[model samples]
Structure formats: C-alpha cells, structure tokens
Target: MLHNRVPHILKRLAAIVLLGLACVAAVHAQDVLRVSAIPDEAPTELQRKFAPLGKYLEKATGMKVKFVPVTDYAAVVESLATGKIDMAWLGGFTYVQSKLRTNGATIPIVQRQEDATFTSKFITANPKIKALTDLKGHTFVFGAPSSTSGHLMPRYFLLRAGIDPDRDFRTVAYSGAHDATAAFVQSGRADAGVLNASVWDKLVEQHKVDPDKVRVFAVTPPFYDYNWTVRGGLDPALRKTLTDAFLRLDPRNPEQKQILALQRTVKYIPTQPENYAGIEAAARTAGLIK
Candidate 1:
C-alpha cells in the first residue's frame, strides 16, 4: 500500500509541474504591448492624452496594451533598448541615442507636426534683448544638454546667429526640463531659456506662466522633434500592426484628439529611421554624443 501511495504522489507532482510550465508558456505567448514617454513632460499628461491611443491599439492589434511612465528623456531610450518597454513617445534626440545603444532599438511610426518647422522660441527676460544676436554675453538656461528642442536646436539657432553658446554666453546652465528652465527664467535665475513652444503654450494657456516676465527672445529654425517609437526586435507583424493603428487613429476621435493636442500633433505621419538622421547629425555636431 505504501509503495503504491508513493508512486501516486510522484505522479501528481509531475502533473502539477507540467501544468505550471504550460501556463508560463501561454503567458509568454500573449502579446504584451508596453509604452512610455520622454522626460520633463508629465507622464500622467501623456497617459491622459494617449489613453485613447492605447485603446485604439488594443482594439486594432487584439493585444493587451500597457503604458509605462518614465521621468526623463534618457529613461525612455534606456527602457526601449533593454526591451523593458515595447514602445515610447520619444524626443528626436533621445530616439537617436536609443538607436546607438541597441543598434536597431527603435522604429518610429509618427512624428508631431507643429505649425512651423523652421522656427521655435527661445524665451528670455531682458527687455533690452530683441533678437538671437542680442543674447550674446548673457546667461542662459537649456534643458538636458541632450534635449533636442530644449538644447540642440536652440544651440544650433544660436550658432546660426553667430553666437557660440559655449563661448558667448556669460554662463550656461542645464535646468534638466523645459518647465524647470521656464521657472528659472521666470524667477530671474537666468536671463533666458530654451523650451518647446507647445509646452510654453500649454503653460500659458493654463495660466502657469506670466508672459510679462518671459518672452520669446529668439526662435530657432524648425526641425523634426517628437515621435512614437516602437522598440526594435519586436515581431515585424506586431510592429506593422502598431504602426498602422497609430497612423490611422482619427483626429476626430475625441480621446486621441486631446492627446494629440497635448503633444502638439494633428496627425500621426509615417516616418523611418532616416527621417531623423538630421537630428543625429545635429547631436554629433553639438558633441552631445559621438
């Protein structure tokens, strides 16, 4: 009787182990879509805006969608490279760095189209300063030295105006985020700062910024900025599915429309890695990375 009972116990244990493995495999096979946002901007704001995007994606792909929140711009790159997240809405600069890290870590589906492509504001205080040339020898603030809108483009415009940011500015400081840079300027900590015009507009619309204290001191030539980037190495089919859903999302869809508004995007246009090569070149020229 004891021998018979021992065999029965072993058989039950083996069956249980096999069942667990099957369950694990089932979970692994389930499509789990993860997404995130660039830093400095509020993740919650993105979640609110992109919530419909996620729902649209889920409905389109028939997969479970997840949104992962990140604090800063670089984190989005790091997360996507490690496969910790499947997709992200990233800054152009961060997207370039992500490619460098994972070799082919990202695939961009859509890029935000602002009203103007050739000019973005460089906000400042000093009523005496009327143009980019007037910024010479004055202190300035730029967001994350790696920031595309906050630093790279702003620096490029400054250089175009014949000002070497590293040399002409009495001092240069990194406030780490556009909003922080705005705060620094608004509080008189810096003479001026670089920020996304959309972010500035939002803050102004919300009455968080006082237009009297800070003004657009200069505007940089418009260049591509933000996009929704899916991690590389994803199944080509899944990537295609997501890319299509994102691009096809209707602007009239109230949920997607609101999110697009926050992102300053009117539509999700198809883009490729090549679309951002100019941004990569700009980063290299600035020496932010090799």
Candidate 2:
C-alpha cells in the first residue's frame, strides 16, 4: 500500500510539471501583437471593414495580431495610452490627444502616400460655393467635434478665410459622421460641412455618397491624417521588424493591396511624432482640446 501510494503521488507530480511546461510553451508560441484601429467614421463597423488589414499584418509581422476596433475616436487614444493596445491607426486629432495624454506614449510610423499628405474638403450644397468665403453666413455641419479632418482642419480653414467657426456660420451642427454631414449638405439640410476627405472619398468610391449633388467648396491645405502609431519603448527588434514589413508592403502584393484599400494608401510611408506638430497646433487653435 505504501509503494502504491508513492507511485500515485509521483505520477501526479509529473503531470503537474508537464502542465506547467505546456502553459509556458503556449505563451511563448502566441507572440501576440495587439492592435487597435479607429472606425473610419463614427458608428462604423470597423472590425468588419478592417479585418482583412488585421489578417494581413498578422502574416506580415509573423505574430498573432488581434485587432481591437474602436468606434469612439477618443477611446482609441486612451487604449493606446494605457498600453492595452500595442499599435493603432489613428486620425490626427486622436493622435495628438494620445501623444499629449500618454506622456508622449506613441509615435507615428506610416501615413498614406497619396500626394504625400492628407487633407479635408469643405462641401457645400450651393454649386457656386467654391471657396472658404462662400461658407460664411451658411449653415454648417461638421463631423464629430473632436475629428481632426472634419472639425479642426476645416475650422482652421474657416479662420484663414476670416470666418470664425464659432461665430461666422448661421448654424453649426455636428452630424457625428462624415457621411451624415455630407448627407446633410446633399439633402439641403445644411449649406456646408467639413468631413474627412478620405472617408468621404471612400463613400463616393463605394457609391454611398452622391458626388454630383454636393461638391467640394474648398480643399484645405494638405496636413497629416491617418497614421500607424505604435507605443513607445517597444522592443527595438520587434519594432524594426514590424515597421519594415509595413513599409515594404507592395501594392502588387495581394496582402498589401487589401491593406492599401482599407487605408486608402498605395504604401505606408515612415513617419514620426514631429510630423504632426501642425495638426497639434491646429487642434489647439480650434479649441478642441488643450
């Protein structure tokens, strides 16, 4: 009976040791890379829209990349700040907020290569409206107040035109989504609105927005927009590996082509924090945040 009891205990101990080793090996195999991507616009199906890109990155970086899609722009910023996410794709407004709030927690890695910059267009219902001057005295709508392309840059353009966004327009409303803002103009609900041009363009590309009914009143000067942002203090080797994979994603490559379509870029361009100083200044001037 003593011998049998000893063997039983020894077998149980061996099993426990094997379990511990298996757990460690499983953790080591995961090599997880957590990522977050802002919905293209408010209330969008981000995971549904960007899943292909997430899968592409997983393969490219040889890690188990899990995409945490965010509908609220600000939440994405917070996630990056807390290290809940390893990387993110953010608009300029959220990016600026993340930088400031996270103790400079992240830096830009890439942006769309089109025109080598990103910009927004002011759309108006009146066909004759073709400049910022035309926006004065017209009822205006903007995307979410925190949106860089939809609100901050557009308001800056308004200021440049000698019209204070807070006081110049007959009425100002936030439609929350660029598509809705455009709809407001198309339906004659508002005279003009500011929207993320890339988002609007994608809608037009998808035939969701009528390009003929509402035309661009003005195209703001090119400024940075969407960027691939990664947390600071990331392991240097892993960082280099990931950045290189993104930069080298060729349009001809099937994996890259899908990512380019989602991001509206031919290829990712290397970028840094300083690249967004202008956007940060724009947000501050617009009084969106400190």
C-alpha RMSD for every candidate? 3.2, 4.0
Provide the lowest-lDDT 10-residue window in model 1.
111-120
Q: Which digits, one per residue and each the tens of the lDDT, describe model 2 over residues 16-123?
A: 999999999967744888888765464445665567877777787778888776667777888888877888878787788889987886877777776246788888
Clashes of each: 6, 0
What's model 2's lDDT at 242? 77
For each candidate in turn, the TM-score is: 0.86, 0.84
Q: Give candidate 1's root-mean-square deviation (CA, Å).
A: 3.2
- Local distance difference test values of all predictions, in order: 0.79, 0.78
Candidate 1, residues 102-189: lDDT per residue as tens digits?
8875787766555225345788778988887777888989988668888887887677667898999899999987888889899989
What's the C-alpha lDDT at position 248 in model 1?
71
